[model samples]
Target: MRVIAAKEFSDRIRNRWVLAVAAVFAVFALAISYFGGAQQGAVGVQGMEVTIASLVSLVIYLIPLIALMLGFDAVVGERERGSLDLLLSMPLTRFELLLGKFLGLSAALAASTLAGFGLAGAMLVMQWPEGSLWHYAGFMLSALLMGMAFLSMAVAVSVVVADRARASGLAIALWFFFVLVYDLTLLGILVVSEGRLDLDFFPLLLLANPADVFRILNIFSLEEVKTLYGLATVIPEAYTSPWLLAGIMVLWMILPLSLAAWKFK
Candidate 1:
């Protein structure tokens, strides 16, 4: 598993895909960090709290898309190339192969996320006040977890689907559901009901979507960010604990990977 993971990681690095992703992340992070408050009529660098709130929106949209794209073809590509059978014919078990692939892809994702956001983080550290860095760190951590969750789902899709084309299509559909349609559907429900939906049950609905979980986790972590994102009025204080949301993100990663492992075996 270690050998496979190392080879896969090295291959992505050698192919320059990892570097390209990191560069993209760095550029976006910097732009959002510096210019996020322009809509609020603020000039110059925004506060760490406000910048983090802005980046959370960007992260929610971008990270999961990148993750799904990266992992959707992991297994199908191997199968298409006739390498999966050869790899399974070796000493490794199917579980080991899947595990190694996940680890490798995860490592690549993590490296890109850290390097790209780390550049922005470094700039924030230099310019922003010292106390709010932890909030930004929490945002980065949650972003990484969100990426891993989607990556796991993509891998599961690859394992269950017959070909890369189907997996690719499923990947896009998953992105649309989670990133776009899910929230819209929820909003539609709320609107159709004329705001009569119970606030208590609404959080459970938010918890169902990993993207919303990511948003709630970061938004509620800091009071300032919560206000900036206007989540203070909607999300209850009781449900905003960092540890609980983090656990849900973990479950999101585990459940999909478990399904993939079962199907692969």
Candidate 2:
């Protein structure tokens, strides 16, 4: 597993794909961090907490898309290139291969996220100088978790599909459903029901979507952030615990990977 992971990481790094991703992240992070408050007629830094809130929206959209693109071809691409047979003939378990791919891709995602967001975060620190950074730290951690979860889903799709074309299609469709359609569909239902739907189960529905989990984890983690995001009125206080949401995010990462492992075996 270690060897496979190292090879995968080295391959991505050598291709400069990781560097390209890091650059994309860094550019977006800097743009949003510095100008996120322009709509509010403010400029520059805009407090670490406010910057985190702005970046949460950006991360939710971008990270999952990047993760899916990264892992959608992890297995299928190898098979298409006629490398899977060569890989399987070696002295390694399917679990090791699958896990190695996951870990390697996850590490790449983590490195890009940290490097990109870390640079922006440093700028925020330099600009603010007196603000606490724990909230921003939490945002970065949650972003990583969200990326891993989507990457797991993508890898699972790659393993299940017989061809790279199908895997790629499935990956993009998953992104569309989870990141775009899910919330819109839910909102549509709520609107059609005219506020008559049960409120108790709404949180459960939100928790079911990993993107929503990321949003809730960051938005509700801090009271000030919550107010800035305007989720306090809709998201009940009972569902705001950071540890609880983090656990759900973990489950999101594990369950998809477990499915991928089973299919690979």
Candidate 3:
């Protein structure tokens, strides 16, 4: 597993994928961090809270797509290239191979996210020279967790689907459903039901989508942001607990990859 994981990460390095992703992240994060408050008739690092508030949408939409694209072919691509059988002939269990692939891809994703956001964070520190670093750190950490959840889903898709084409399609479909459709669908249900639908279960429904969980994790933590989204009244304090939401994100990471391990055998 270590060898496979090392090889997978090495391949990402060899292909310059890590650098490319980090660059994308660094550029975007810096842009958002510096200009996040432009609409208020001013710009530049307004505060860690406002900066994180602006970047939340970017993390929710962009990271998942990148992770899915990176991992949608982990196994299928090996099979397509006629190397999967050779890999299996070696002294590795299916679970080991699946885990190695997931972990390796996960490491690459984590590194890029860290590198990108860390650069932006450092810049903010240099410019502002004050604020709780913990807030910015929390935002970066949540972004990593959310990225892993999507990457796990992509790995599962790669394992279950018959071909790379199908895997890619399914991955995109998952992204669209979770990132775009899920929240709207929930809102629609609330609208159509007109108080008939149990309002009590709404937060639980949001938990069903890792993206929403991620959004809540970042957004609700900010007093400056709470009233803007109006979710302050909606989500109970228990659900907004950072540790609980993070555990749910970890669960999101595990279940799909666990399913992939099961199916890979």
Candidate 4:
């Protein structure tokens, strides 16, 4: 297991794709922060906050995109290249192979996310002395878990689908549906239903969407606007507590990884 994981980890670190994706995230993070920081205002803050928020919102989509790019070929690519037969002939079991690939790919995602956002967080803190470091850290952490969930989703899809192109396409389509269309669909339902539904039902509905949960958790930092997006203007701040939000975020990470593991096995 260790040897397989090590080999997979080394392969990922040595791959050009990992470096390219990391570069893209780094450039976007720095460029947005630099331009957004120079124009600091409530408008600027909202703009800057939105810029970061946009990245968080896209975490689900982006992570799976990277994962499929990296791993849609994990088994099938090797098979097509005529390497899988040799790999299977080795002492390593299929479970070890799948797990090692998953872990190594996960590590790649984590490293890329951390490096890009870590640099961006440092730049933002330096550029704007008044900004909240804690808030930035909290959001970065939330984005990491969101990324993991998407990576797991991609892995599960890759394992289930035999054709590499189909697996990649399915992974991307799932991401698009969840990120772009899911919220719009939910809002449509809410609009048609009116305010008849209880406020408590929102959290239950939110469980269906890791992205929305992520949005609410990150946006909670904007205390000034919390009332506007709050459960209700009459409700106390405690009604939208951060710890509860974090718990929901944790569940998103665990559930997807479990499904992936089961599928792969």
In terms of TM-score, which candidate is strongest? 3
Model 1 spans with C-alpha error above 4 angstroms:
40-42
Candidate 3 TM-score, C-alpha based: 0.96
Q: Give Cα-based local distance difference scores for all models.
A: 0.87, 0.86, 0.89, 0.66
- Model 1 TM-score is 0.95
lDDT order, best first, reads 3, 1, 2, 4
Per TM-score, what order, best first? 3, 1, 2, 4
Worst 10 residues of 3 by lDDT: 125-134
- Please give, for residues 1-265, the per-residue lDDT of candidate 3 as tens digits: 9999899898998899999999998898889877877888887667777778888988899999999999999999999989999999999999999889989999999889999888878878665545547777888899999999999999999999999999999999999999999999988998999878778989999988889998999888788888899988888888899999999999998999999999988
Query: Which portions of model 4 miss their true places by more than 4 Å?
Result: 37-51, 57-61, 79-82, 224-257
Name the best candidate (by lDDT).
3
Work out how many backbone clashes candidate 1 has. 0
Candidate 2 clashes between residue pairs 3 or more apart in a chain or in different chains: none
Residue 189, model 2, lDDT = 89
lDDT pick, better of 1 and 4: 1
What lDDT, from 0 to 1, does candidate 1 have?
0.87
lDDT minimum window of 10 residues, candidate 1: 222-231
